[model samples]
Target: MPNCNAHDPYTQVASISIADYDYPLPESRIAQAPCAPRDAAKLLVDGPSRPIDAHFSHLNDYLPPASPLVVNDSKVIHARLAMQRSSGGRFELFLLEPIEPASYEAMFAARGPVRWHCLMGRAQRWRDDTALTLGSHPDETLRARRIPPHTGGEGIVELSWATGETFAELLDRLGQIPIPPYLGRCATADDNQWYQTVYARHEGSVAAPTAGLHLTAPLLRTLEDAGHPILHTTLHVGAGTFLPVKGDSIGAHPMHSERTVITRRLLQGLLAASAPVVAVGTTSMRTLESLYWLGAQLIDSQGPAALHLPQWTPYQTDRTPPTAESLQALLKRMDTLRVDTLEASTSLIIAPGYTFHVANALITNFHQPRSTLLLLVAALIGARWRALYDHALRGDYRFLSYGDGMILFNRNCKKA
Candidate 1:
């Protein structure tokens, strides 16, 4: 692709080779289960001069005083369902997003039949017209059929069930929590609670925002006591978070869009913040950074009704506005429209060359090699991310979801 703004960081970072992000992750380091007390997990504080090792319970000690923490409270739905063909062959349907009604809230409230974009486990054997049934429950019957693919070539499945209950209820009774596949095991009894964050509220995500999994109720209280403002926004994590960078360069990889909902209160907090805005997870970081660009679009008079962010929007322009100015513009628009919440989808990719506008620090877990999550870390700390990873590996810290976490500050930020 051609560089529209030669001096911009996005232009430099967008063309970076994915191979540069690769690192050796031993299968032994992948944590399959979480520690007993979530706060007992280890924390690697990526300090200014060197990385400091500490327990997660001591996270407050590492944070800059009075920092506002933004967390993703999008809950993980039981999106994985097991079904059987009449011949007794079994298959699974992994729900991605609502299809028919095109809204998560509307789809969950819907009764009887609902359509969704899904990935079939035994897709080859599932004929177009054939139907599959959930385990024989006499009172509540559930059935599924393969529908035509979406315009993007993703498979769509139609699910029909009747129990005088909402689709959400049916899922709670029959579906399993879709844990990360790297766990190399089926979703067990513990995952229903273990994989979810204590702060999780809205039901939509297929996967857990793992970094939030390390926070316990007491830890949250301690932070509040220390005068750190704890707030939340929602970003329903998608299955695409697990997808690897397919090509050599990031420019060739397609980014997935996730839905976000930010409240007027959160916007006000951000505008009034006198300290660094700390994002509790990659999802939250993405949401905060995307808000800046969304606000920029609003300043440009982009239609508020249609507010989907494209992947390359940041790179397309060199117009860097003051963060507060952009945020105030959004607040002005919200006031004129008389809305308390702003809902939009973002496909923003935070790579090495990306400039930080909102979040000044990030708290997150170790990510997979060559993954977009790792790239986001690189964007904050630059190549020192490699050194931090090396230190974590050498120090015997566990990796991935259900493992340890770290607190990283952006190099450009004053707190660092």
Candidate 2:
């Protein structure tokens, strides 16, 4: 929660316009590649008084002696696929997620034809009957049919391959890693490993939870040796995460909902934490925040409203649970439902004046100007994001995914 509650979070009347968040970033400043040793990237640690710059390998120096590090373990799949039209016009299909089966496991295992949400680059020239072949094999052919846009100009494509291999195997054989367009280059062989975290297990997200990229196995072992418990949850990052904020006022912008799942065990660890909970990435932070609201709505459930999180849900009303109560409510609901897993979607936007329900500290990659991600960083430390960004730029730190990482803490709060 915010230190002060006199002002409503909806309007955030004192907040600056979108233009204020914009800063001059040369294309050269954006990191085109990952650091050779992932842990060798730079780290910017900001405390209540001052900010210090260090290397990610020395992450323990900046954090509390011991704490809970909540990580997003959603694996980045080979979402980018290449399809050729009969006319030899090449189109790109970036698979968003499975729409037909909806279950990640089932979709990966489904053999015949399957429909999925996908974003296309050269969508204009494609037609329903256009057949696309993959990997120079007759068995890997697919059709490019279109579906209604999901949101924010994303188009869906229905694809099917003849082989018995799972979709996951097909992608591994024919798809490229979906590197951000801001990188201004095509995905390369190096990205196959560097773009993903060492601990990535479940295959889903189109993009990586970049912050986790810094934690090498050795470093993780070191942290564990020192008694910090590392817990994980999944939030399959959608392509929309890379989209920039277009509206002048963030209040007018609609947030993109992402699929998230937190098991009862993970929730138990979160609620039972005796130390500060540090969210490893913005997605993880959003998951924790959404969990609190999920519990809140569960507390006073009138119906299915418990599942939906509006863009302005955090700021719409002043009423909120005191962190502890929210977790208890979630536990109670989960017990009543006799379920160990909480599967839901979240569209929560963390703008300035938004009080954080969980995550006392954040470890994240440097974001772009006027992006929802930047707004999230701002919400954590208010206007200090500009100063931090400047510090990062002046220190010659690389920016964006596959770039360097930074850590920042909010005002002191009790453990959740």
Residue range 1-416, candidate 2, lDDT tens digits: 33244455555722447887899898888998888788999998986677787898999877786788999999999998887876788877888878888888788887767788877776766665666656676765655566654454366667777778888888888889988888888888988998899988888899899999899999988888887889989999988898776777665666778888868877888878877789999999999999888878776663273466766766766568688788777777678789887678889888777778778899999999998899889888887898989988888999999889899888744444
- Consecutive 10-residue window with the lowest summed lDDT within model 1: 145-154
Model 2 deviation from the true structure expressed as Cα RMSD, one decimal place: 3.2
Worst 10 residues of 2 by lDDT: 1-10
Off by over 4 Å in 2: 1-8, 13-16, 147-154, 302-306, 412-416
Candidate 1 lDDT over 1-416, as tens digits, reads: 55657565656666789999999999999999999899999999988889999988999999999999999999999999898988999998899988887888888888878999988886888887789999577567789988875343358888898688899888988999999999999999899999999999888999999999999999999999999999889999999999999888898777888998878999999987888899999999999989889989888875568677888888778677788877887787779879988778999999987888999999999999999999999989998999999999999999999999999998785321
For candidate 2, what is the TM-score? Answer: 0.93
Candidate that would win on TM-score: 1
What is the clash count for each candidate, in the order shown?
0, 0
